[model samples]
Target: MKERKIPEPKPLFIERMNRLIPDTNDQKNYWKIVKTEPVNTIRVNTMKINSEELIKKLEDYKWKLIQPWKNYPEILIVEGKTPSEREREILINKNLAKLEPGELGRTLEHLLGYYYIQELSSMLPIMALNPKENEIFLDLCASPGSKTTQAGNVMKNTGTIIANEVSLGRMRILASNLERCGITNTIITRKDGRSFCRKIKEQKIYFDKILVDAPCSGEGTLRSSPKTFLMWNPKTIKALSRLQKELLKSAFMTLKIGGEIVYSTCTHAPEENEGVINFILNEFKDKIEILDFELPLKTRPGLTQWEGKEYDSRVKKTKRVYPQDNNTEGFFLAKFRRLG
Candidate 1:
């Protein structure tokens, strides 16, 4: 397949970003326009039903199940028209008049807390984390509980999860989603993730696994919220990069020796993706090892070969999912294990 051409940076955007990251190349392209198809996905509550039984039930209803993710058995990919159209079609076809606005809201399974409406690609990083039963997990910047809920489902509601979000508004949304999904193993904390780490410092409350799904400039989410581009500027990216590095450092500190941390972002910017990871690796050299992970779907690793700047060799283990390749949001995920 030919490489999908990334969109060039707009002059206004370049001017703004250059002010923030002065040496930023005028030809640098971080945003890409690709056709995004909305996928209505659900994770079968393994606490409620097994994958086979869930598949059988959906098949009986004539709903075609796409391939199952390798690590997450209860999670299934379902095809439909994009976004609102797909939800409308499902309601009309199934005669689900009372269904709510979100994906899978009207489905009997969703009402019964059998599944959740998550973007298929969004589920990748959490799946890669592979939360195990009885393990203590921390979602440093978790909000709206997408990945947090996925971790809960993976543990089958057995372990404890610290779902921390800085904003009270997004925390409420996260709490509601967890409740709807019947997730009870999480403690919702409304605190800046970095401060939370410091507060718990002496408690020795290190996590078995920590997920640093840090905040980005929303460059990758432009397709979902195109209006974001209206405010897109390099200054925003630089500021977000600094914030990401700090959050990641705190996440690293909270990780138990020999534990793993999964760093991910929705943006395609190297400054936020590999650049942040490289900073952590350098600060904690000889104390962390990158893990290799591959998805069954087609994707690429970080563009380490970009420009003359060399990325850490460990970047090869990181995964990059493109909007054009996956028909989902552009994302980057890297798994790292602390060496004791």
Candidate 2:
């Protein structure tokens, strides 16, 4: 048996990105930065433990931990490799500990849900949403439950959260993570996000804040999931953009007047980012306004022009984080508030 080799990005995909980002030195730096692996990052589950205690525990293992974001001490970039076999054997022999997988998740802390392993940029959408206590919230495409869990944490289990996933297989994982994180404030639902939002809106259930983390081609996640390149297709991008626009549309309709909605995706495709936002801006016109938010990491404004197609100037309020921008996965986030 032979190990399969990973595939590289399609030439068309690379060409598209080059044109989209079209700066000579930036293109060089982007290529260089994206080739390297992202450092392991974990967000300490504050529902279970304090950041200081978790930092102390991990540092005892000689892990050099760095919290890269301001005022967010729970986000830790773990440096140094996991314990080697020799070191594990010594600990097991001396402390009567059992042999275990030498990975970050194999620790007692993780097993107890003291922290969650998530990509750095993956955390941005929740931050952009700025979840609050006692607010009705919905994670439109919640699965694997990272953002859902973060939203629950921010609300401190005070609000009702609807965590919806279309896939039965993914729902199980979402449920498990929610339970693992001890989040009791969420209601898990299985339905297509667009239909689910519509169904709830029909019942007169309006959310105070909503997060439509629309699915996309995942072009920005090449650093974490290189297989994304193999799955990348121009046709797929177009299909996803359609679904994204619908999802955002449904979420906006379900949001109460003066409520906020955040649209985010883990792809650099302008079709999925500014394009989708543009659709909503036109669809709702004066009823929706883009809200600008700042981040602690490096990010660029959303493009106003792509391939000579112009988007609403307000789309520039959207934020784009490239892999090289924060040494994290590529991500796009835009915030909106419903107006009467």
Candidate 3:
């Protein structure tokens, strides 16, 4: 089979992003960063092994690993040339965890659940969630089990996590990853995340914490998944914004009073970031409040004004991580507390 060709980013997408980022020089830097390949990175699966042990094990294989951040010690930046197919399989067969060409998915360490090949930025929301032992948490859009498994590790496999994914195929993959990682506290469910409150009304289940990693235009993932530009448009962001708001509502409803919810997306579009958070703030002003949190990486505050429209001033507490900021994908994250 022929290798797939990555399509050039669409002009409209570029124009809209350029407009969103007012700094011309930074915009130029972002363009240069996204068009090139992203760095290869992974997180140590603490459930299987601690970062110290993993680093020593990989070092034996002649791999150099750099800790991404002092705050995020489990994440490591891998430095190496892309391995040939034969070399990759050899490394995998040896149970070594290393970067593969095209960021391929198959590897023995992955099968053995030693580590997870996650993007550096994609791991932030779970970190923000800060799952603890014996707490009940909900992952509204958990799929392929990256965050869910990470949550299990954070909980020390002691808490119950409802991992919900609407798609059957993705649910299967999520289950597989959970099993591979020895995550036993999570209960898998297939359902529309927006309908959870209504579907489980009789049960009256409430979570101590919730994560709504809503689906969006994925504008920030252009470096890893270049085809995002092909499917991206202002209209798509508009449509997903409605769905995202509904999902946020369901998460808030299912969260116990005083529980915290982390809402995140892989898009820079303000409509899906500050805009959705603003809508929730207005709709649930008396019941919810945005909480300020800090990350080790540099981040821009959530946009207060976009396209001449102003957002809730409190939305400024939300954080935006740009590609240029940390050489990672663009991501938005906000933490909310149920005040009622």
Candidate 4:
């Protein structure tokens, strides 16, 4: 048996990050550049089929399934041939003479609503929230419905979910995704999540759980989509952080006492991840408590002491998943519960 050498973090890049974030040393050995492969992950619609039945159905197609985590029974890491490979397989397996260009598009399961293609890392935040059946949940700034759809599936369509998005174009995509995923318990709203929160407060309404998957500089998603890194700049990170703080404040206000809120971002920047969570905890110190949600997989906690800046001790409860460690997009998630 041979020993495998662990990859080390890039020195120059890490040094720069240390300058930007004092606690860089906490993640020194944990960071590394890893190849990002586009994976097609599907969340089973438990509302429509249980995990056992879904696995049985997918097994018919000989799709290899990997059970990555426990809490999510419907979650599976599937291995299948590429689009062209699947096309050929379908023709041979189903005895079809030739595959039409739209055959995959017109499949009954897809049309009738069976599953959704989502990034494994993108799905982590919603899974962390762990929405229960019949609970009221809101996806602040939800668009394209990846997290929204996942939350809906988690609730098994028994809860009320308000999926809010500011962009009309993105809202349409969200609606379409919900339709395809057969998610009917959600109300799609086109309004700034901050404003929506104010209205909910005026009406004296509160949500059981809220997800503030805030907009960020998208630095963590560079490997998943290069466009993110192409547009990244120091100024953009600062600007997005300001908006994220406001959104977090609103989300905090709209949550009922004893309810929980999960804050997450795809960016690796601390300004958006730990910084935002730190701000919220300080502002609402007496009203909320940080909940340490355990990850099914191993991960690093937020830096306790970074670069001469003392972050709130609560920041230690946050989780960070590096691309090199998870073989997925970089992500950060922190769950907080409202106190009476």
Candidate 2 stretches with Cα past 4 Å from truth are 1-6, 81-102
Badly placed stretches (over 4 Å) of model 4 are 1-33, 56-62, 82-108
Once fitted onto the true fold, the runs of candidate 3 whose alpha carbons sit more than 4 angstroms away are 1-6, 81-107
- Of candidates 2 and 1, the better by lDDT: 2
Q: Candidate 1 lDDT, tens digit per residue, 102-213?
A: 5456667767767777776778878788889999999999997889988998888887999999998999999888998888899999899888998877688989999998
Question: TM per model?
Answer: 0.80, 0.92, 0.91, 0.82
Best by TM-score: 2
Error of 4 at 88 (Å): 14
lDDT of 3 by residue, 114-189 (tens): 8888888898998887878999999999997889988998898997999999999999999998998899899999
Error of 2 at 35 (Å): 1.8
TM-score, cand. 4 vs. native: 0.82
Candidate 2 residue lDDT tens string, 214-264 = 888988887667788788999999999999999999989999999999999
lDDT of 3: 0.85
Candidate 3: Cα lDDT at 117: 83
lDDT-superior candidate, 1 or 3: 3
Question: Judged by TM-score relative to the true structure, which candidate is superior, 1 or 3?
Answer: 3
Residue 99, candidate 4: C-alpha displacement in angstroms: 16
For candidate 4, lDDT tens digit of each residue in 1-340? 1122333334544564555444555454323343334344567766676778777766555555666777777777665422445566665443223323333234455466676656678888887888999999999989989899888887878979999999999999999989888888999989988898999899998999999999887766755465553465677878998999999999999999999999999877788888888899889988989999876665679865554667998798999887656666778899999996
Best by lDDT: 2
